[model samples]
Target: MNIAVIGTGYVGLVTGLCLAQVGHYVTCIDIDTNKIDQLQKGHSPIYEEGLDKLLRENRQQKRIEFTTDYDMGLADKQMILLAVGTPQKNDGSADLGALFSACRAIAEHLSTDVIVVTKSTVPIGTNERIQDYIKQHAVNNNAVSVVSVPEFLRQGSAVQDTFHGDRIVIGGENTEAVETVAEVYQPFNIPIIKTDLRSAEMIKYASNAFLAAKISFINEVANLCERAGANIDDVSRGVGMDKRIGNHFLKAGTGYGGSCFPKDLSAIIAYGRKVEQPLSILECVQRVNEKQMDILAGKVSKRFRGLKGITIAVLGLSFKPNTDDMRNAPSIPLIQKLIENGANINAFDPAATETAKTLLSDKVFYYETIDGALKGADCSIIITDWKEIIDYPIKLFKKHLARPIIFDGRNCFSLKIMKENGMEYYSIGRPAIFPIS
Candidate 1:
C-alpha cells in the first residue's frame, strides 16, 4: 500500500510510521517544513516511546518518507489518511479549519483513484461532508472515496495499542472504499467492525465518554467509601471480579487528564446540542471530572488552614507516564490553587519536567530529583504515577521533609505501607493515615 498521512502530529506521525513498519510504503505530509525536516533526520518532534527508533529503521529500509509538498506527497498514493487534529472550540464544538483545509489541498493535488480515510476523531456525517466537499473542489471529483476510521490508540502505549488493539472499525457507504480501508489493517489480524460512517464516528466519541464516565464513577465511589469507612481497593476488587465489569480504569485516582477524553467528551456534548438532542449524562461526567481535579487541593487547604508561606513538595506533572503531554493534566489546576493560596511549590517528574515548564512557567520550583523536591518541604503531594515516584522508599519522606505528610493523588502507595512506615498519608477515597509521632 502506498499511503500518504497528512498533518504530522501525534495521530499522523504514529499512523504513518506504524503503517510503514508493516511493509507498506508510507509518506507523511505536513505543512510545517521544520517538522518535515526533523523527520527527515530520523527525529520525532514529539515524545513517544519506540517512535524514533521505528521511524529511523523504516527510513533506512526505504519504506517511509516525509515531505511538505502537497502535490508530490499526494501524487500516486492509493490511500490518503487525514490524520490532522480537530481541536475543540470554546463552545465545545470541534474546529474543522485544519480538516477542511486539508480536504481542499487533497482535492487540488489528488491524481488517481484513492480511498481518503479519516483517522482523526470527527463528528457524525463528517465523512459525507468531506466527500461532498472534495467532490466540489477536487479536479478528479469522481476518483475519491471517503471512509471513516477513528483511532483508539492510548498515549503511553500507542505502539502496543496499534498492534494489539482488539478490534478495528472501518465504515463507509462505499463498499469498495470500506474494504480497501479494512485491508490496510488486514496484516494486524484484528477483528473488523464494518458499519456506516455515522456509527463509526459515534463509536470514537462513545468510547471516550464511557471511559471518562468510568474514571469519574470510581472517584465518586471512592468518595463514598471514605465517608462510609469502606475500603475502595477492596470494593473495586470485588466489583471487578464480576464477569460483566472488567478491572480496567477501575483505579480510584484524582481524575483522567489527557487530550482525548476531555476534548472528545466536550465535543460530543456540543454535537448533541447542535443536533437539538440533550446529553445530560455526558455533561455530568464532565462536571464530576472537573471537580475531581481539585480533590487534593481541597484536602490540603482544609488541613493546612491557609497554606500561606508553606513549601510543599509535588511529584509528577504529565497526565500519564511514558509521555510528556501536559494537556489538561490535573497537576495544573491543583498547583495553581496552591500557589493562589500562597504556598511555595517544588515539583519533580521523571519525564515531564521540561514540558511542565511550558505550562507552569517559573511559578513553581522544578527539582532534578524527587528528594530535592521533598528536601525541607512541609509535605509531599504525589500527582502523576510515574514509577520513580511510586518506587521511592516511604522513609525518604521522613528523612527529607520538614514534616512527613503526603497528600497522594494517585494512591500509588499502599495504606498498609504508609501506616507501617509511620508516614502521614492522605489519598482519595481512602482512610487517612497519620504519622506515629
Candidate 2:
C-alpha cells in the first residue's frame, strides 16, 4: 500500500509510521515546514513511547518520508488518510475548519483513483460530509472513496496499542472501498468490524463517553468512601470483580483529562441538544469530572487554613504518564486555584516540563529534579503519578519538605507506607494518615 497521511500531529504521525512499519510506503504531509524538517532529520516532535524509534527505523528503511508539499505528497498515493485535528469549539461542537481545509487541498491535488480514510475522531455524518465536500472541490473528476476508520490508540502506549488492538473498524457505503481499507490493516491480524459511516463515528464518541463516565462514577464512589471511612481500593476491587464490568478505567484519581475525554463529551452533549435528545447522564458526568480536580486543592487549603505564603511541591504535570501532552491536564486548574489563593508552586515532570512552561503561569518554578521541586516546600502534591514520582524514596518527602505532608491526587502511596514513614498523607477515597508525634 502507498499511503499519504495529512496533518503530522499525534494521530497523523503515528498512523503514517505504523503503516510503514507494516510494509507500506508512507508519505507524511504537514503544512508546518519546521516540523517537516525535524521529521526529515529523523527526529520526532512529540514524546510518545517507541514512536521516535519507529520513525528513525522507517526512515532508514526508506519505507516512510515526510514533506510539506501537497502535490508531491498526494501524487501516486493509493490511499490518503485525513488525520487532522477537529478541535472542539466554544459551543461544544467540533470546529472542522482544519479537516475541511485538508479535504480541499487533497481534492485539488489528487490525480488518480484513491481511497480517503478519516483516522480522526469526528462527529456523526462527518464522513459523508467529507465525501460530498471532496467531490465538489476535486479539480479533476477522478474517483475518490471516503472511508471512516477512527483510530483507537492511547497516547502513552500508542505503539503497543496499534499492534495489539482488540478490533479494527472500517465503515463506508462502498463495499470495495471498505474492504480496501481493511486490507491496509490485514497485516496486523486484528479483528475487523464493518459498519455504516455514521455508526463508526458514533462508536468513537460512545467509547470515549462511556470511559469518561466510568472515571466520574468511580470518583464519586471515592468521595462517598471518604465520607463513610471506607477504602476506595477495596471498593473498586470488589466492584470490579464482576465479569460484566472489567477493571479498566476504574481507578479513582484526579478524573480523566487529555485530548480525548473532555472534548468528546462536550461535542456529543452539544449534538444531543441539536437533535432534541438531551444526554442527561453525560451532562452529569461532565459536571462530576469538572469538580474532581478541586478535591485535592480543597484538601490542601483546609489543612493550611489558607494558602497565603504556602510553597507547594507539585509532582507530574502531564495529563498522564509517558506522553508530553498537557491539554486539559488537571494540574493546570489545580495550580491556578492554589496560585490564586497566594500559594507558590515548584513543579517537575520527566517529559512535560517544556510543554507545561508554555501553559502554566510564569510564577511557577520548574525543576529539573523531583528533589529540587520538593526541597523546602510546605507540602507535596501528586498530580500525575509518573513512574519516577511513584518510585521516589518516601524519606525524601520527609527530608525535603518544611513539613512532611503529602496530598496525593493519584493515590500513588499505600496508607501503611505513609503511616510507617510518620508522614501526614491525604489521598482520594482513603483514610487520611496522621502519625502520632
Q: Give the best candidate by lDDT.
A: 2
What TM-score fits each model? 0.97, 0.99
Distance from true position, residue 395, model 1, in Å? 1.9
- CA lDDT, every model vs. true structure: 0.90, 0.94
Could you tell me the TM-score of candidate 2? 0.99
Q: What tens-digit string does per-residue lDDT give for candidate 2 at 233-304?
A: 999999899989988889999988899899999999999999999999999999999999899999999999
Clashes of each: 0, 0
C-alpha RMSD (angstroms) for model 2: 0.7
Model 2 has a clash total of 0
Model 1 residue runs over 4 Å out of place are none
Alpha carbon lDDT of residue 165, candidate 2? Answer: 91
TM-score of 1: 0.97
Task: Show pairs that collide, candidate 1.
Answer: none
